[model samples]
Target: MLLPGSGSDDRFVRSAFAGPLSAFGITAVTPVPRPGAAVVDGYRAALDAAAAEPGPLVVGGVSLGAHVATAWAVRHCAALGSRLRGVFVALPAWTGPAGAAPAAQAARATAQLVREAGVAGALAQAAAGSPPWLADELGRAWPRYGPGLAPALDAAAVEPAPTADELAGLDVPVGIVALADDPVHPLAVARRWCAALPRAELVISSLAAFGADPELAGRASLLAWLKAGGR
Candidate 1:
């Protein structure tokens, strides 16, 4: 499934994944948030909806959605058992323990930005200064869907970030694609997630590469890994 990056809905994936991933015979499934649906519930339901489609089942998403996809699959995989294929997670947001001065500052700034400007202003500001292809991706995505993102942000941010201990329970095979420069989706957090989860592998990479070449960058590797598991 095409689990999208944060605040992005399926449209974000459409721009990023339509051409590159489909070549692998992968049908990315990006689900819209149901009205009044709890953010987490919507993601959980997205996984269910994707799994129900005729074909093989695998779960994946970008950033917060990526985190949600893996967390949900980790919890449910044993029941589905081996039918659960590997996960392809791109820039999974780091909700883990944070003592970094820079990260702490960025987190506060992000929270305040969203609070003051709503999702649009916050995302627009982030895009303007953001280097590489991600700026283009977020710029296109935020304006079209930013107003509706308040609920999703509220749902993910309301709680204290997910603890590493909590993630340890997720043992299903997972392939994590981590970016180097993203303040929110840091390499440190990706390493932590990989270490915490039992059956997980991580590939360190730059944020620019992920956005610029969806086919050649770590994303391609992620898809290859997921497919190799049992496709």
Candidate 2:
């Protein structure tokens, strides 16, 4: 199962992961986000539902989605045993508490902007300095959140990702993808996660490359997982 980042929907997840997963004959299950503060719980519920299915499961996503997947994997690894295949984490934003993290601060600021200026206004402000591809992505996604956008962004901003300790407890192989040039999702955070995980590999790509082809991150992540003995 794959989930989207803060303010993003399953459409972006599908665009990022579907083609790459399909190349390996793996189906990507992208779930729609539940509105408001329930967003994280909703994603966990989706992971729970997917875990009930028969086949080996690989759960992952980008940014906030990556945090949720890692937390779920840590929480359920022993219960699920080998049925839990591995994790593919792309652009992990922070470790442990969300306190003062750049991504968290950005999300909070965005949420405030959304509340004060509305989605269209917030989007315009965000797009002014964003890369063209990122602006396009925000243009497509931010509006989809509608009235729930601010609350969801706030919830994600404050939500805690798996800590270094939590990550260390996960025995399954992990594939991590990071963009060296992306400041919001720092490469240092990704490196910390890779170091903490018992079995893991890291792949570095440029945000420009990812902007040109969404699947680049996914492909790199899967390759990292393979290198870490995921299959």
Candidate 3:
């Protein structure tokens, strides 16, 4: 299963993974989130629901979704054993307490902007500061999330990430893809995850690569998985 970042849906996930993973016969499934729902809890529920589905499953996600996937694995290790094939965590936003992370700070700030200025005005502000492609992406995906986007960002800003010890405890093979220049998803954070996990592979990727090929996220992650010897 593939999970998208905050303000994104299954379409983005599908675009990122479907074509790339298909070559290896991996069918990616991305779920749609209910509007106005709590992001973390909603994704956790989705993860639990996925666990009941038959067949081995590889779980992965981007940004906040990546954090949720790892947190879910830590919370449900017993139930997910063997059935959980591998974990693909891309763009891990934070590592410790929520507010301590740059991404969380940015999320909180963006939430405030959206709340004060509304979506259109917020988009204008974001576009002024962001790369054209990023602004375009947010422009397209943010509206689908509706008014809940801000609150979701706020909730995610404060949501706890798996601790270093918790990360070290994971027994499953893990793959991580980090955009070296994305301060929001710091390469240091990704490196920390790679170092903490007993079994993990880390690949440094770039925004340019994604622009050149949207499927590169999955391709890079799959390579990381193969490097970790995932079947």
Q: Which of the numbered candidates is closest to the native, going by highest lDDT?
A: 2
Ranking by lDDT: 2, 3, 1
Error of 2 at 137 (Å): 1.2
Writing each residue's lDDT as its tens digit, candidate 2 over 67-169 gives 9999999999999999999999999999999999999999999999999999999999999988898899899988878998999999999989999999999
In model 1, the worst 10-residue window by lDDT is 96-105
Best by TM-score: 2
True-structure Cα RMSD, model 2 = 0.8
Tell me how far candidate 3 lies from the true structure as C-alpha RMSD in angstroms: 1.4
Instruction: Please give, for residues 1-231, the per-residue lDDT of candidate 3 as tens digits.
Output: 788787767777788888878999999888885555477777888887888888888888888788888888877766778877788888898786876688888888989998999888899998898777678788888888789888877887888788889998888888899998887889999999999988899999787876667787888888898788677
**What lDDT is obtained when candidate 2 is compared to the true structure?**
0.93
Sum up the clashes in candidate 1: 2
In the predicted model 1, the residue pairs found to clash are 2-29, 3-61
Error of 1 at 72 (Å): 0.6
lDDT of each: 0.63, 0.93, 0.83
